[model samples]
Target: MTDKRTTAPALLCDVMIQIKQRLRPLESQEVLWDQAAGRVLAQAITAPVSLPSFPRAAMDGFAVRSSDLEAASPEQPCQLQVRGVAYPARPWPGTVSVGTAVRIMTGAAIPEGADTVAMLEDSEVSADGQFVSFRRPSPPGRHVIAVGEDVRAGQVVLPAGRVLRPQDVALLVALGLTSCPVVRQPRVMLLVSGSELVPPGVIPKVGEIVDSNTPLLQALIPRDGGQVVEVLRVPDDPVLLRQAFRQALTKDIDVVLVSGGSSTGDEDFCPCVLAEMGELVAQGLAIRPAAPTGFGWLNRAGTLLPVVLLPGNPVACLVAYELLAGRIIRHLAGRSLDLPHCQRTAPLRESWSSPPGRLEWVRVCIEQNQAVPLRQRGASSISSLVAADGFFLVPEEVTLYPAGTIVTVYLFDTLSGQQF
Candidate 1:
């Protein structure tokens, strides 16, 4: 266990890899383009047809040859016909050739004979319906959208691994994509096991704490694009634990997370349950506040469900999510959790210490451009994280940092409105 302190992040990272290897990137399904934003693409999507499949009008004006406008300025005017030149749709073939022009609206298909567009502002309609006049020369392709200008027919408009945004949805719609291929959201089962835990809103009769991990994990999992298929808060009863675990697995769930009961505490039944069910892949990571995090495989009737066991402490839970579950989620979503690309520099506003073994995840806030440590340090400080702005990692070699030391603050949440 002591050796794990130095090797914890790596060991936890290995557990992340192990679970990721067992789980599959979600399957693909068709979702309406308008509703597809924030969903991951299952496969590479190429344009079904050339965007602007036909040369189309980009403005509500007359389609005319550029040469007509070349000579005509505000002083000089060019006259064209309304009937044969432009119509609501493409006029007859050879309708507006060379000197001729057609009236078109925005998004209307360009006529076969028209090569340019003359804006209405640059032109005026005569007293008669057959006559149109423009004061300026229209350039070639003016106000005209060229075929395939937006997306080529065979082009990979969006490659795989694209997280659909609102703008992407609009583009897909413009390309006539009613439904898009999106990776299926994995169903996650979050099970919190503790005998000393009470449900929320329950009056605490001394020594009883509400089980915050259940709700926190339930919310966190779905935020990563996975569906929380089940949430169970069973006491330390082994029978109830097994029953709840089985129930969570009974429904289709991709991942199973048993919260708390990982340490060598008196009522820790999670390890015993793992032994009775299947193989324990790894147990007891060597890290502060989250040292008891565990991971293993649970076989129920020969079906293996990758299980991630995190410590009961709220901070430990967060760290487990970052180093373990978060990586798996990012990987499954076709992303990488590499060394975060960020400035990583902030001034420490407070002092903290950890033994020279585990990397300390110190929560701090940036005040007046300074990184200030939060009020909590031990594993049980639940309220301390709420007051902090961001966190920084103290390498295993470090013991403590005095205030005013310049350190790299690796932000996990939205500190300074940054994603890093």
Candidate 2:
């Protein structure tokens, strides 16, 4: 009996909505402050104690009552007796009396009865080390950072669902937090299958191609906040693929990505094996370069696991991941439902063309504020992805966009030598 499982390609927006509705979020876990970088915060953080927590000198200077230096100048300086030195680690010995000053270093606590600071450049010390003369007048509270000025106690330092960056971690450390509650990284498994595929660093024997999808997906998954737990290779046999899928689902796998066997060829048995073992949600998408992509759900160990089938072509695989897998990964990590890349609009230097009824992702490079389409070399060319700055989308309704049309460019990097 012939199988009748082929379904029409689903709209891109509909597929995304379905994914958002079906996938469940992962749980939160405690992580050290250092390990929390790039992880989303599970709870809001309030400052336990104020930064600095004390009034300190902002620079190397002498602390004194401002009224005493009212008549001070370069030609006629005000002289005061030297009291004591105030180092950051050691407090001043006594309060400043009238006509007396204390020598203080930067960040040292200001002493009692001192209302102003006269910088070292504007003050002269006597040879006997007994007196200091101020050449310029200083206002009360000048050069002094008041307590809680940087961060007040009980202030909200970080909000929930924020992705922690290096600066964010530093701020948490400054606020005296040794650890943070962050959403746990999702566990992912990668399965690459093909009979004519060989491992990287090995010379392919004439008709074999080196497995690039494994490394590609490995880097992409972790970069998007999913931890890769296992990567395995299987031959063009349905039994091996089915066994591997079931084994992974029985473990603590949150998602499974299968590459290179999603199409309907004689050896392309991924869709069939997955259909026999689980429920297929999507058979295809109306998307250029990655129409053979598919998604499904498997029940194992009393939990549902999402398995996405990516195209064999390198570029198509990357595109499919960005479209579907990225959303699920971000959701599992408690990140916002938005692409992490910085987006901008640029005019097209040349007109773009695509067949109607499919969403197309056109690789483009930014040159002189113009988006220039990269040379089309089909979906297997990895070099095109490397040379591209980002991609511009062509909606399914339109077939052509004229030159000089401003289009949104979803950047892969900031192009400012920084990753988003």
Candidate 3:
């Protein structure tokens, strides 16, 4: 398991160079308050004013200054004249000369002269409105709020490259900010090439099947944080494919994905077309079911737009995209490397065989804690992938397994919510 292989479609130079090169950063723009949730912040966000502006009451109890309640104890008593309840920004009754108290409601501003106001539960009131007694002594600075405690004015609350969460939106609103800056979504262009492929609704004359890759790809593009600006399909000809690539680059696409015509067959003109677009770093890999995967770039107009030529098989194409092309897309979108790939350890139900010097990913279903290998591992058929929850890798160095051995499974579907 510790051994490694350097079987990429391109040279190490191209791969490393492209990863180091920083593509165009997303645009900076403002969005409405309600719509700013889950967007990246393009600029540093600072607080215009201190949070709470004033020492607002966090509870419904009375507001107090620390000095007045220094010696209040349970055994001793204190009394003050009953002042009426105070409202927000209202005038105080007057200064406290000696042994005087004010009745304050929750969130009311403290009077100018009053140093502290004790809670009603802590003191007993007299019918004469002049006596109050505390059974227990109270502490100073207790139950008091200070200004600028939560956040200070001009303080940077959120930094740039910060992706705003739902709570972030609320915090920005609390700071009196109306809009926020965010990056622009990445744009993608798709090209599907093959003469044997026909549209689904078209009645084929002979030797033709409906093209399923177009609809499948169109549906998956937007979910990966890239917008599908356009999806084009053309017959199996180099002229058409080359023309499509040039036309797509003119429209300013961040990445271009061309499906089919990537194999080693004579009709496979995608590699030639790819060489013309950008220099081919590598043309083949050591992986099974996708050995013919090609990598290149469109270096026209100083835009080194990476092009991923996926195999024609639907399952192979998708899995390859998820494993390889998915990484490039994440790089473009400024996302982390940790994709939602699931991992699990399941018992092998039975033994299996694979070709030598090749890594095989076998689809399996978890049935009663056993990894049941699907009967058919077809490269072209997409139906086999529908019921699979994960795949167990048969390493090139490994070709045999006992029934009960523990094998790590790279899950396709989530193995969540299990009682075990």
Candidate closest to the true structure, highest lDDT: 2
Error of 3 at 382 (Å): 3.1
Clash number for every model?
8, 0, 7
Candidate 3 versus truth, CA RMSD in Å, comes to 6.0
Q: Which portions of model 1 miss their true places by more than 4 Å?
A: 1-10, 20-23, 73-76, 84-94, 97-99, 124-130, 246-249, 301-303, 332-335, 338-345, 350-353, 397-420
Per residue, candidate 3 scores C-alpha lDDT tens digits across 208-324 of 877777777776665555678887887887788888877877886788777888776777788777776676655764556666677777786876778888888887787667656
Clashing pairs in 2: none
Candidate 1 residue 117 Cα shift, in angstroms, is 1.3
lDDT against the true structure, per candidate, is: 0.73, 0.88, 0.69
Q: Residue by residue across 1-420, what tens digits does model 1's lDDT show?
A: 111212233355456666656766766888887668888887888888998788888878887767666788677787776755444464445556666667687887787667887888888888876778888777788888999888899888887888787888888888787998888877777788887888888987788898887777776665577767767788887788778767865778777778888766667777667756777766677566687877777776676777778888888998877667655665555554553324468777777777776766777777888888776777777777776666787776889888778997766553357432
**Which stretches of model 3 miss by more than 4 angstroms?**
1-35, 41-49, 73-138, 144-162, 196-211, 342-376, 390-420
Compared with the true structure, the alpha-carbon lDDT of candidate 1 equals 0.73
Candidate 2 C-alpha lDDT tens digits along 31-59: 99879999989999999999878889999
Q: Model 1, residue 402: what's the lDDT?
A: 88
Better of 1 and 2 by lDDT: 2
Per-prediction TM-score to the true structure, in the order listed: 0.84, 0.93, 0.75
Superposed Cα deviation of residue 70, candidate 1 (Å):
4.6
